[model samples]
Target chain A: MLSIRNLTADVDGKAILNGLDLEVKPGEVHAIMGPNGSGKSTLAHVLAGRDGYSVSGGEVEFEGQSLLDLEPEERAARGIFLAFQYPVELPGVNNAHFLKEALNAQRRARGESELDSVAFLKLIKEKIAQVSMQPELIKRPVNAGFSGGEKKRNEILQMAVFEPKLAILDETDSGLDIDALRTVSDGVNAIRSPERAIVLVTHYQRLLDYIEPDVVHVLAGGRIVRTGDKALAKELESKGYGWLTGRDEAA
Target chain B: MTTGEQRATDLEKVLRRGQQQLAAGSAADNWLSAVRERGASDVMTMARPDRKQEAWRYTPTSFLDKAEYAPVVEGPFGAIQPADVEELMLGDQQGTCLVFVNGYYAPALSRLAPGQHMPQVAVLSGQLGDVPAQLKAHLDGIAEHHHVFAALNSALMSDGALLYVPRSASVQAPIEILHVSVGLDEPGICHPRHLIVLEEGAQAQVIERYCALGEAVYFTNALVEIILRPGSRLSHERLQEESALAQHLSDLHVRLDEGSRYKHVSATLGGAWSRTDLRLNFAGEGAQADLDGLMLARDKQLNDVHLDIQHTAPGCISRESFKGILDGRGKVVFDGRILVAQDAQQTDASLSNHNLMLSRSAEVDTKPQLEIYADDVKCSHGTTVGELDHNMLFYLRSRGIPSARARQMLCQGFAEEILDRIENPALHGRATRLLTERLMTYSE
Candidate 1:
C-alpha cells in the first residue's frame, strides 16, 4: 500500500512535481503516462529519495509510514526499489560483488543475518537465469561496457533479487528492443505477487501490452489530470497526449 | 642568512629532542654518537628550503609547520594491523629475511629462504659491516652524496641490515626486508638502515617493507643504500604502510656501475607525514636505472616522494614513473628529475608523474624535471594532475550501478594499473589488499 497526498518536489529549488497524487495496493499494477516535461521521471526520483530534491510541500506515505523522511539507502532497506533510468557503470566493482554488498547492507540494516559469498552467489545465479543474464556478465564490473538494453534488464534482475515490496519502474523500456522489452516485462510479471505493488512510469503503451495495468493515470503540468483503466493507455497511444491535454510540452 | 633569522622552528624542536635523547645514552650503548656530535645546531639554518629549491617547491615545506611536531619514540609501535588482517603483508620470496621492529632489527621473526646460491642476510642492528673488500670502494661512497638524512644516517645509524652477493654469483630468489614500527605505549624513535651490494655480473631481488603496528607516535628515519657492480642486475621493491598516527622519513641511495641494470619500485599507501627521497646515480657507461613509485593517501595524510636521477656516463638510460591517488583530506607531493652530464652523450632518459584526486579536499602536487648538457642525449619529462574521468563515471552509472559504487570501482581500476607491474604473486596480493583498504576507507 502507498499514498501520495498533494506531493510537491523540486530539484535545486525548481519545482518538478507539484500537487501530484497517486496510490496503489497489493498485486495492483499502476502506470503513469506523461509527456517530456510531465514530471514522469521526477516522480521516480522523489519516490527513490534521491538527494538535491527539496520537498517544499505535501507528504508521501508508504505502507502507512511517511516516506519523505527516509534516506535513499533507508528506503532501499525497507524494500522500496527504483529501477534507475540510467544505471551507473562501476569500473572495477564486480556486478556480483556490488549486488552482494547491496543485499548485505540492506540485510544488515534490517537486522537479518548476512549471506556468505557461496550462498549469495547461488541465489544470484538463479536470479540471472530468470532475467536471461549470463554469469560472466555478473562477474565483470557492474554494467561496464554493457549495452543499453542489457543495463535496463540488469535493473530488473536486481529488483528480482531484492524482492522489494514496492517496485517503481522509471522508463526502463526506453532503450530496450522489442525482444528485450518482452523479456523485461516477463521478468517483472514473474515477480508480481499479492503482497507487492508495481508503479510503472512510461509514455508508450507498448509496455502495457506485457503486464496490463489496473489503472492508468494521465499526468500533465506537474499534476495528475486523469485516472482511467487499461483502455485509456490504448486510447492515448492512438491519439497521443495532445487531445488529452492542450499544454505546451517539448515531447 | 643570519643566525638570528634562524630560530628553533618546530621541526628543529623535534630534531633537538631526538639529539638530547641520543646524547643521554653512553657512546658504548649507541653507534651514531660520532655523527650526533656533528649534529647541526642550525637545523633551521640549513633547513631553509624555499620555493626556489627545485625539489622543495611543489611540496610546501610550510605544511610541516615550523611548529606542530611530536618527538620520536623508543618502543614497540602499537597494533597498526588489525588482528584479522590479511596473511600476505610481506610476500613469500626466498632469500635472507631481515625484519625491523620499531626501526630496530627484529631477528626473532625472520626466516631465510632455503637456497644454495642465495646471499646471506645479516642484521647490522647496531654496527654496520666493516666495509667488505669487494664492495669497500662503493660502500658509503654513494651515501655521501647530498641528502641531509643520508648524512645523518651515515653519522647516527644505530642498527641496520646488510645483504652481500659475491661476484659472478647469480641469485634467482628474492631477499625480503620487513620493518614493523610499533606505535603504542612505548614510543621513542627508530632509525633503520639497509646496505645492499651486488658484485659484478651478480643478479638478485630485494624487498624493503615499513609497516607501523599499534598507536605509537615515532620517527622512522630510514636509509637504504644499494650498490650494483658492473654487468649486475638487481630488482628491488620498497613498501611503506603506516597508520594515520605517526611520522615516516625514508631515504634511498642507489648507484649503478658500468653495464649494470638496476630497478627500484616503491609502493607508498599510508602514513601520517612521510617523505621518500630517492637519489640514484650511474657511474659507468651502458648502465641502466629504472625507478617507479605509487602512493595512495587518505584522511589528513601527507605523502611526499622526491627523486633525483644522475647520468654521469654515456650510453646510459634512466626511466621514472610515479602515480598518486588522494582522498579525504590527504595531500601528496611528487618530484622527479633526470640529469645528464656534459660528457654523457647518447644518454636516453624519460620521466613522468601522474596523479588522481578523488575528493575535493584532497590535493596533489607533481613536478618532473630534466636537465641535459650532452647535445647528443635524448631526454624527456612530463607531469599531470587531475580528477577521475567524468565520462568514465557517466559510462559506469548508465548501467544501473549506484553512483557511490561506480566511483569506487573506477578508483580501484586506476590503482590496478600500477599494482599489475609486480611479477611476484605474493607481492601483488599483499599490495592489492593494502590498496583496496585505502580506497574503501577513503570513499567513506
Candidate 2:
C-alpha cells in the first residue's frame, strides 16, 4: 500500500532522512522504533507533505501515485493520514465543525455526497464512542485547553472518523498515561481492517504492548538498520539503541 | 496661510453651510434652537483635525474635502418596503423597532409594542414642540460636545429615536433602532442622534444598527448617549454596515452610576471611511463596564476606533477588547486610553487590541494608554499586529480542508473571539453571518 525508496529529505538544508527505504503491503501493521533525534517523526511528516520539509531526492509512492508531489490536503484526500505528536490548538474552530469540514472535503474530492450536519453529528457521536472520548469535548474549540490525554484521544477520534487507508501514528502515545495508552490502542485496534495499513512511529515499545505489530523496524541515523517481528521491540527496550547504532551509551 | 490652515478654513465653511441648512428648517422651540447654535459655534471655532493632531495622526480626513455633502432634508425618503430590510432584523427581538430612513423617522416602517409594559419610545423631531421635562434634562446633560463629529451631529441633527426605561422595570425584549440611508440624487448627509436612559434598578438591551440601501455617496454622522442610573444595567450592541461609497462617523458616550453595569459590543464591517469615538465614565462607586469591538476593513477602506474610559469612583472595574481584520491595502487604527482618578481607589482596568493582516500592504496602528493616579489600582494593556499563524494554517490544511477555505475559517475563528461575547444568540448568529459574508469578499 506504501513504498519509500531511498527517501532523502532535509529540514532547513540539514539532512534528516538520508537514503531511507521501506515498503509495506495492504493490511499489515509496521512499527518503526528509534531513540531521540532519529528520523521517525520526520518520515511521517515527509509522507504527509508538510511544508518546510523538502524532499532532497528519492520517491514516495502511495497506491501507485507519487505522494511527494502532492500538497498536504491532496495527500489527505488520497487516504494518507498523519496523527501529529503535538496536536495544534485552534482557538475558535469548533471541534465538530472542523471534523465535518475535513470529512466533507475528502468526500467531495472523491466524488461522494457530503454529509449534512445531522448525519455528521450522528457519525461523529459513534466515532466519539469508539475512541472513548467525552462527547462534550466536541462542542469546544479544537484542542484548546484540552488535556494531553484528551488531545491524544481527539487524534484517535479523528482517525476513526476519517478512516484513511494509510495511517501514520506519529508518537501518538508520547504524553499518554497507561490508561490513555490502553484506550488509544483499543481505538487503533478497532479501526484495523484488511483494507487498511497502519504504521506506528514511536520512541518506546510501551505502545506496542496493547496493539501488537506484525513487523518492527529499528530506525537510527535516518535509516532503518534492523527489521524483525514483535520480539525486536522487546529486545530494543532491554538493550537500548547503542548496539545497533554502534555508539556506546557510556561514551 | 499654510495648507493646514487652508483646510481648516475650508472645513469650517462646510460646517457653516450645514448649520445654515439646519437653521432654514428651524423649529419654533427656543431650547432646540439654542442646542443647535451651541453645537454650530463649538464646531466653528475648533480647527479641523489634521495629521499633526495626536488623535487623528494615523487616520486622514482628506476625503471629506473632495466631496460636497449637503444636508438631507425632510424627504424624498425612498419608497422602501419592509421585505427589503427583513434580513437586517434580529430574529429574537420581539419588542420595539424604530426605523429611520435618510435621517427621518419612518413611522409606517416602525413597530412599537402594543401594551404599556414596553419602555417609552418617541421620535425626537416630533417632540420638539412639547418635549417632556425628563427628556429635555437628559438630552441636555447626557453627553459633552467636545468631539468634532459629536458637535457636527448636534448642529445637523433633525430626527432620532428616544428610549426611556422607568425605575425598577426589567425589560425582557430587546429594543432595536434601525437607521437606513438610501442613495439620493445628490451627495447628501444625515445626523441621527439617539438617547437611551435607564432609571435606577432598570435593565434593558438596545441594538443600534446603521445600514445603507445602495452604493450612495453620503455621510452618516451619528451620536448615541446612554445614561445608566444607580443599580441599573444596560447592554448596547451597535452594528455598522454602510455602503462602500459612504462615509460614517459616530460618537458614543456612556455614564454609569453607582453599582450600575454597562456592556457594549460594536461590529464595524462597512463604509469606505469609518470612525467611532466611545467615551465611558464611571460616575458612582462600584460600577462596571465591559466594551468589546470587532472591525473589518479592506480595499483601501479605513476603519478607526478611539476609546476613553474614566474610572472616577472607588471600587470600579472596566475591561476593553478590540480586534481588527485588514486586507487589500486596508488601514485600521485603535487608540484606547484609560484613566483612574486619584479618588478612585481599588480600581481595576485592562485594555487589549489585536489585529490580523491578510495582505502585505495592510496596516494597523494600535496604541493602548493607561494613566493611573490612584495608589491602589490594577491597570494593564497589550496590543498585537500580526498575520495568520502558519502552524495553525498547516494544521487545518492537513485535515483535508483546502488552503483558501482554511484561511477563511481561521479568520472567522479569530473574529468569533469577539462575536462569542454577544450573549444574545440571534444577534451572535447575525454578527457571525455578516463577518463571514465580508470575509468572503476578501481576496484569498
Cα RMSD of all models vs. native, in order, equals: 7.1, 2.9
Instruction: List ranges where model 2 is wrong by over 4 Å.
Output: A249-251, B1-14, B24-30, B127-131
Give the per-residue lDDT digits (tens) of candidate 1, residues B73-170: 44433333333223424545556666666666554566656655346455554333343444434445466525454544554555677777888887
lDDT (C-alpha) at residue A242 in model 1: 80
Model 1 lDDT tens row, A1-251: 88998988888778888899888898899999988878998888788876567888888999899988876777888888888777766655667877887887778778899999899989998999999986688877777799998888888889998898899999988978998999889989988999989999997899999988999999987899989999999888877888767953333
Q: Score the docking of each candidate (DockQ).
A: 0.11, 0.82
Q: Model 2: per-residue lDDT, tens digit, A1-251?
A: 89999988999999999899999888999999988788999999999888899998988999998888888899899898889999999988999999999999999988899999999989998999888899999999999999999999999999999999988999999989998999999988998899899999998899999889999998889999999999999999889889999886410
Name the DockQ score for candidate 2.
Answer: 0.82
